[model samples]
Target chain A: MSTRIHRRRHAKNIAAQVLASAATLLALAFLVWILWETISRGLQAIGISLFTKITAYADQGGLANAIVGSAIIDAMAIALSAPIGVMAGAYLAEYARSTRLGATIRFLNDILLSAPSIVLGLFVYVIVVLPMTAVTNGTTTFSALAGSIALALIGLPVIVRTTDEMLQLVPSTLREAALSLGIPQWKLTVQVLMRAAGSGILTGVLLALARLSGETAPLLFTAFGNNYMAFGPLEKMASLPAAIYQYTNDPNPALHAIAWAGALLIALFVLALSLLARTVFARGKTSHD
Target chain B: MSVASVTLDSNRGRDRTDARNDALFRWALRFCALLVLAALLGAALSTLWGGREVLFGDGWRFLTSAQWNPVENRYGAWAPIYGTLVTSLIAIVIAVPLSFGIALFLTEIAPAWLRAPIGTGIELLAAIPSIIYGMWGLFVFVPFMAAHVDPLLDASLGRLPWIGTLFQGPPLGLGLLTAGIVLAVMIVPFISSVMREVFQTVPVRLKESAYALGSTTWEVAWDIVLPYTRQAVIGGIFLGLGRALGETMAVTFVLGNAYGLTASLLMPGTSISSSIANEFNEAAGLHRSALIALGFLLFVVTFIVLLIARWMLRSLQRKAGKA
Candidate 1:
């Protein structure tokens, strides 16, 4: 009986090992396939003209305007979210501590962190875009500002959560030393605590930007994708993800090629940002924490 | 006043200014923190207010009806809701076991040199954006599936009872199954990473004792590590489920966005997020409100899933404390 039990367990172990290895291989293979597909198709479609002009007409268009538009939108979003996130994080660490309101806000923010980006876009559309159209007598104008608002909403929770966690990691002894110097509360926070936690907070900001830049759903309802080189915030703006979305939806092969190129650009940009953020924060952790 | 008295007055005045500055700054920080909460409430309130037109205009029929005609101003959410649930369920089913296997492989079996690099590479998967996943799903994955896997399923069991119908159809490749598979791929990193973390938290002593009892690697993983982290593992699954439910771009590309109910996973269908994404732009007046209402519904579903997940996590912490 003992021998039989031992043999059965041995077989089970081998089978389990096979299953585990297969899963890992599948996962790794899928990753390679995606990167391979994006690069091969996207690289071929890239051209000097692709970055120098607005999408001229269908198969003739470049991604210049879309790239610029994404930059403008994400910059605006970071500008809006970072200050608010940083200050709120300070309050959570410095003042509120574990107060009722702080805990509640933290909980809700955590929910919003995982909330669908499209829903936030709808919220912004209902609040900003739709109302703006109604006030303007229905011209159907999709603006960079509206896209920024949507992106900001999507990024807000990420920044707040990161700021809060990073601020907590700043040691309490640092705060006491700053206070001993008779520094004002704001100065203590800005000069001492923030300096100590700077890299972690910056990591959070970069990660948020990385997250907001790839968002196509929210931009669909807000930016709505301009086909020309529009420069105004109130003007409809083209974005790389939106461009990719539209191009792939088109039945033309040339359009599909452009979409692939746009996908490659967005993927590389986001990947680089995240890797940079990770390395920066990982260095901070090893050097300090 | 004497010179000493004059200097004392100035010093006192400076102290007062500093104290006031501290108060003002403290209050400002507090207000900023309040803004985060305000934004959360504002989103929920505005979504509710925007959907007031739909909520009152259509009543419960919005949830019950299957017909969606924006020109005629009519809508029903049953089909999209069903699609969302089914796709998420498919994702969880495909992802859970695979995530467990990968987690076990990383924690219990992998060689030391390969571990860190493999773990880091797997996490790089999260850095790829959802829209890119959508693009890949549309351009590469769809064609691959339509060419190979769909035909195999059709030739084999496309004639059975319940599940056979799921494999029925011309294998267009843009359907529920494709969306589910894509979502499965997207969520693997999340669930597997989380599972690996949880599995690593199992007590070293417990694992060592199990090994000493002549238990094989698989037995230790299945009988020892599995039971120890079961609740935490479930919580990780729910986290992935929450993501799958609200996933928009990737699912939108592959889900085909057709509005009908069938057991056929091969059939084209629409999810709530995809419905909102596809129609929210051109949808005017009532159609617009209905789409916002859909967004609201998606929010509620994901919110509930997250809350349950949090509850599970809290319980798991308690379980760990007792252990």
Candidate 2:
């Protein structure tokens, strides 16, 4: 290449580098701006009462019911999803690793992993909520159970993907050693393989839980948001995201303040879970290596 | 002789028990695996079933018409469909380039010591809930756009001869453009991470050869790295596009939820998801069915998009394995 062409190419490369750096800075700036806004506005609105009282119409209550409801719903969702996801993943990794069925399931699971949560919510509404409502003769069927089911669907694929990948990482020699001992395939998988992948699976579950807690779309119609404290799986429930969504929509200033507080709590909890999951993942990687 | 026979009998019994338990456990695992497939089928079928009333009743008009009047029990998906497509288009146009930049910065430009932390930071941005974006967009970014970006567009792009009409509108802050920007922000981390992963897959030797030929980093990236991972890169972009199409709460807050399509990007409009979310709560009878139909439409569109993405990525993976 001629010297002039080389210099022009260098100039173009320099320009590209500048643009790339600026893009990174812009991305980080957005993150900081969001965090700053959420913390500043949220801290002002957060008070003891915000945690102690149930939401009141127009202004006088905190997010106690919502916090409790969200906890119940999320716990139930993880409980329902984690076991099935792990089992499905185990099957894929051990029994069906090279099978056509395994590849199909894995592909479907990946698609589900990115499938829209709101569509899942609509599915639950049609399959679970509407049927229950019909059976109960128009009594509201929007409940914590419905919400949990929706969220579980969202979490299920994440757990499956992680567990499958983690299990695949296990040394084949471990399987051979166990099999040489005359261990049953089931026993080897459950006792040894699962133990090896336990921390990795936990990381997946924690990440799923983090994702579930921040979900607003699936819970919009399923749990449907309650103002009062209620724990029944069959009754409408309030969750942090649902409450935040509702409050944000209302024209009331006080409601908006409470919404900010809720957003702060959720953002903090999600960030913490993500951090914890990363730590667990990093530790697991080191141990495995 | 008696003791030996007793021990043999005990061992036989244990083996039988083990066999039985193994068979049962294997069955259970298979059942769980099948359940994942079942869930996907159930979601598709159930939504289709729920939306059948409108699907059959309104026939093709449901998709082609823009009329959405709950009071008259008349509904069509035209406006929301148009909005979803337009906003997602805007999101991809803005996000793809920015993501490419971020990915390039992370994979090539950033110092080795700084790479991991910055990469993790960007990934963490993806972990932030979409709802938080919605809240921030509604409360903060919308106002900023109204004050700054909209006016800039109005003065420059809005004055253009042909496409000016698309930019002309009242700058109330919440509209298709605002929602698109928010969606772009939401998907940048996802696309960038995917890009970074695939970009890293470019053979070091190939890049080195390019550099030895006096090619610049940009030249190497544009000519070598990009073409090598072209399939996966497009797959990643499609993945982000699918997400933008289905995103609900963020767009719901900023989309302004208008009923009809308009010429200007500044006008408020609804998406398939935001419409379902905003109306599913109290909509009754045919109105509910209409929203369900919209959901079904979104489900099918996203499924096709995601399937293509997965296929592209999988093909790339297979080729990589062979290489």
Candidate 3:
């Protein structure tokens, strides 16, 4: 009787295992389906003119201008955010230790980290765009500079948190050795500690860049959409995300196809960034080990 | 004596130069830190100031009034507020159980070889952009819901008194219900992954003890794993809630952006983000201020919720440390 019961129990366990595997496979299949659908639809629109020409009359536009605009805005955001994010991270990790201020900063940082992108856009609109409109002359409008600034704000908390965590992961023994050499605390941080944490910091920056690159909500109010390519930082510029939004709404099927292509490019960009970050961090870990 | 004096003079010069360099570097680092603090402060203060007019001017009336017309100079955010809350609540109700079940399955039941690929697949879902989700929802998911899911729900549940009212609708493809479902899909991966991580923190010894006692896998999970990771699981739920609340583009596309409340989930409604996205460009005068006020309320709601989640997670971390 005991043997029979044991056999029944083993059979039930095996059934459960099979069911679980089936569910996991279903979930993975769903992901692959989405990816395949996106790629197939998106690839149909890619062409030579897609990379070299500006947006033309309604149906025949390429993404050359949008790509340039996105690059410029993202680059500016990174330039503005990196120094501040890294320094704040350094303070949180090295200076504050476990003090009350440190705890407060950490908590606030986490809140900022999770705060919604739409709220950030709203904040910028209320604070920057509306005020500028109220005070300035005629037809005050959104600019690429304003958009980049908002993106920088969105990127800031992620970089700071990542940098802090990575720096903290550096063992205290390294710090002690640097101190024992009679180097100042600041020098130890910049020369020894930061060097050790360099790859992690780079990964964090890359992840931040990946995140902000796809943001559409914040730019809506800050950059507004432009049809023609305007190279000025102060002018309205076309970004891949904003272009996707506009083209998706267009009545033209060709424009809709272009939107798919734009989305594919954006996805590819994010995927590359994440893969780069993973590679760097993996190398860093192996080296440390 | 002459040799000793020469060495001492050189050492003194080296020390002076090092001190100067260190001082400059420290000053620069401190300045940068202050600038970061300033940026945070600026973001907060400007949001507050920009919305201060509406916040202080009509205060309570601003929230209660339902009207939102720009040309006639009347404004209210009740519809948007209601839409945001209802959709998010619906999303959480559906998502929590599904994610929890998936997490349990993955951690306690799945075979070893199946785990890694499944985990990676779920994480990849989190990586997909909101815009792509919006596009997919617009073209594919909404039509599917309208054709199949809505009809089924109406046919089955339309007779029950309370539940019947919820399903009663024109079966339009885009509405609050569709938005809520999309949100559930978007947030599932985040909640499940966090729950999985927390479950792994449960000590191996505890599981081994349960196994030795002949406890079933489900029994071991219910008795040991659930209790061990309860706090973290709650934190993970709140994190998912935060993401759902703030989700914009996908919600914008499917929500239909109507400015009213209705008993039927099939009717169109507007969220804070969707309203802002749909109308911010054309708004002028007090209309802009009112919209900004709506944005302020959203910020406050999300900020408080996120703060609470952070506090919960911190306490959970402390408890884990003690254990």
Q: lDDT: which candidate is best? A: 2
Ranking by lDDT: 2, 1, 3
Q: Report clash pairs, candidate 1.
A: A55-A61, A56-A61
For A61-101, candidate 1 gives per-residue lDDT tens digits of: 78998999899999998999899888888888878777988
Compared with the true structure, what per-residue lDDT tens digits does model 2 show for residues B222-271? 99999999999999999999899989989999999998778899889999
Categorize the docking of model 3.
acceptable
Which pairs of residues clash in candidate 3, taking residues 3 or more apart in a chain or in different chains? Answer: none
Give the i-RMS of model 1 in Å: 1.5
Query: How many pairs of residues in model 3 come into backbone collision?
Result: 0
Clashes of each: 2, 0, 0
lDDT measured at residue A77 in model 2 versus the true structure, 0 to 100: 97
Candidate 2: stretches off by over 4 Å: none
| TM-score for each of the candidates | 0.96, 0.98, 0.92
- Worst-scoring 10-residue span by lDDT in model 3 chain A: A18-27
**Model 3 C-alpha lDDT per residue in residues A18-67, reported as the tens digit of each score:** 65555455556656766776788789998887777777554676888888
TM-score of chain B of each: 0.93, 0.98, 0.92
What is the per-residue lDDT of model 1 for residues B76-185, given as tens digits with 9 covering 90 to 100?
A: 88899989999999999999888888888888888978788878777777778998889899888898889998888887778777779878888798889999999999
Chain A (alone) TM-scores for all candidate structures = 0.96, 0.97, 0.91
